[model samples]
Target: MLQQRQDVINHLAETPFWSLIKFYMDDEIVATDRKKKSGMDLIKIIQCYDSKQQKFKFGDHEPKAITSEDVVEIFGLNNQGVELPNTDKSTKNMKDSFVKAYFAKQKIGKKNDIVEAYQKLVQDKTPEGAKATASIICVHLLQSLLFATFGTYIAWSFITICGALDQISKYNWAKGVTDYLFKRINKSKKKRKNGEESATINGCIALILYWICLHTNLLETISGRENMIPAIGRWDITKIHKAIRDIRVEEIEISGRIPCVEPNESIGRGIPCSEEPTEEHSNINQEECNDIPYPEQNNESSKKKENKTTGRKRKRTEVRVEEDQSITITEA
Candidate 1:
C-alpha cells in the first residue's frame, strides 16, 4: 500500500505540475517563517501586465520585459512534450469514460466533489485507492490551479491523462499553461479597458505574480538560490511590504503599512477551503466539498497507511491532449 501511494504521488512529481506543489509548500520551500502573499497586490500587477509589451508595470517600477525563457523558469514546466490535445472541446468520450470509471457518469461533479472523494480514498489503505486518489488530484489541480475559472462542473477532460501518466510527460504542459495565462491576460485586460469593473482575471495568478517578480529586481534571494530552478522556490516575499491600490517598489518602505483586513489563517497554509476535512472523513458518497488543496508534500520515502485491500479494477482509458494542453481517450 505504501509503495502504491508513493508510485502514484511520484507520477505527479515527475510532471511540470510539481512546480505548483513546491510553490504551495510555502514554509518548507522558502525555508523561512511568515512569508505572506496576502498583500500581493496581485490584481494591480496583473492589470498592469502588458502582454503586447511582454512586460508588467508594477507601481512605479520600471516596466520589465518577460521572455519565454522567463516564463519557463517561473513555472518550471517542461516545454519538451507535445501540446495537450483539445479534448474538452473535441469530444465527450474521454470525460464520459472518466466519469464512468471514477464517479457516477451522470453525477457531473465539481472540484469539491473530487476533494471529498480524495479524502475518502487516501484512507482506504490500498494501491487501487491510492491510484484513484492521485487521478482525482491531477484533474482537480489541472482545473483549480492551471485552467482555473472554468465554469462549475468539473473539467472532466483532464481525467483522460490518469491512465496514461507516463505519456503526460510528453505534453508541453508548460507551454500550454503559459499560453492559457496569456490568453486570460489578454481577455481580462481587454475587458477592463472596455470599462468592465470586474478585477478578476483568472489563470495561474501565483505563477504570473512570481513571473513578474522574477524579471524585476525587487526580492531577496531564496536560501539555496544557486540550485533552485523554480521561481517560487527562489523568491523571498517576507522582505516586502503589504499595500493596497498601489504597491511601492525598489525597497522603499511606505510611511505606514496599509491596514489589511485579512484572515488569521496563514496565506501559506494552503487554499482557503470552506471547511477542513480530516483523513478519517467518511463521506465516500458525498458529492460536494470545499475546493481541494494541494496534497501534503512529502518525500517519496515517506511512510504509508496500513493495509486495506485494493478495490475492483475497471477498464482503463489512455488518451492525449491537443494544443490546448489536453487530449481525448478513445478506448482502443
Candidate 2:
C-alpha cells in the first residue's frame, strides 16, 4: 500500500499540468488585466512520507499531519476501487468532437442554460459533486443535440472519462487529452475545406473544444466502443506521453494583448482630408503665392464706376415737333 502511494506521488511530480486540475483550488482566478496575473489553485500537497514516524509530512509547515484519507480524497478515489471512468483515448476523442460541434453552433443561450443546470444540480461546497454535475450536464446537452435519435447508451460510451478528474491518474488523463486534440486538429483540417457546412472548425474552436472535452463527459451510446476512429486504443500512449512531456504551466499562460479601440478622433471627428487645404499660405514663398492668382476676386474688385453714373445721366431732351399735319388738311 505504501509503495503504491509512493508511485502515485512520483507520477504526479513528473506531470505539472495535472496540478492545476487535481489540487484543492483555494481560489483560482484569471487576470482581468496585465497588472494582476492569474493565480494557480494550491493543491494540498503531501510532501513526503516519514517511514520512521509512520506518517506523511506536508513539508516545513506540518509534519506527520497528512493521512491516507486525505490522500484518497485528493486523488478522488471511490469507496469501491481505484478504477476511473473512460480515461482511455477514444473516450477523450468523443468528448472532443462533441465539444467542437456544440461550440460550432455557438448557441450562447444554450450554453448558459446548461451551466445554470450544473450550478443548480451540484452544490458549491462539494467540488467532486460539482465536477460530476458539470460533466453530466455537458454530456446530456451534447447527446440531446448531437445524437438525439441514436439513444443515451451510445453517448455514455463516448464520455466514459467524464468527471473522472478526482478518481483518474492525472498524468495519463492529460496525455489522452493531448492525443485527442492533436488528432482533432488533423481531422478538422480535412473537414474545414468544406467550410462550416462540413468542418466548422478553427483554432479558437479547437482550443475550447479540447478544454470542454476533458472537463465534460459526453458519450455516444453504441455497441462497439473499442472500434471508434481516433480511439486512444489505436494510438501508442508512450509516444503521446513523450511528445508532451515538456508542456508546463508557464506555457499554458496565454500571453496576449486585448484589442484596443482605434483612435476615433481621427476617424469620425476630423474634417475630410480632401476638403481641408493642407498647404499653408504663409509657408509658400512670396513669388509662388503671388503666382497663384484669384481671377474672380480681382475681376469683382476692379469693376468700372461708370455703371453707377449711367443710370442717373439718362437723356432728357425735349420732344421733337415732327408730322402733326393731319388736323390742318381736314380743316382745308
Using lDDT as the measure, the top candidate is 1
Clashes of 2: 12
TM-score to native of every candidate shown: 0.61, 0.25
User: Model 1: per-residue lDDT, tens digit, 157-190?
Assistant: 5656654455567777777776766776777667
C-alpha lDDT score of every prediction, in listed order: 0.47, 0.25
Tens-place lDDT per residue, model 2, 1-332, is 11223333343333322232222121111111111100011101111323345333332323432222322222222223332234122222334543342333432223333344444444433544445444544333222222221111222333443434333333333233323323333444444344533321111111221221122221111234233221221222111121112122122211211121233424222122122111121110011011111101001111221111101111212211111100000001
- Every model: Cα RMSD to truth: 13.3, 38.2
Q: Which candidate ranks first by TM-score, i.e. highest?
A: 1
lDDT of 2: 0.25
User: How much is 71 displaced in model 2, in angstroms?
Assistant: 24
- What lDDT does candidate 2 reach at residue 307? 18
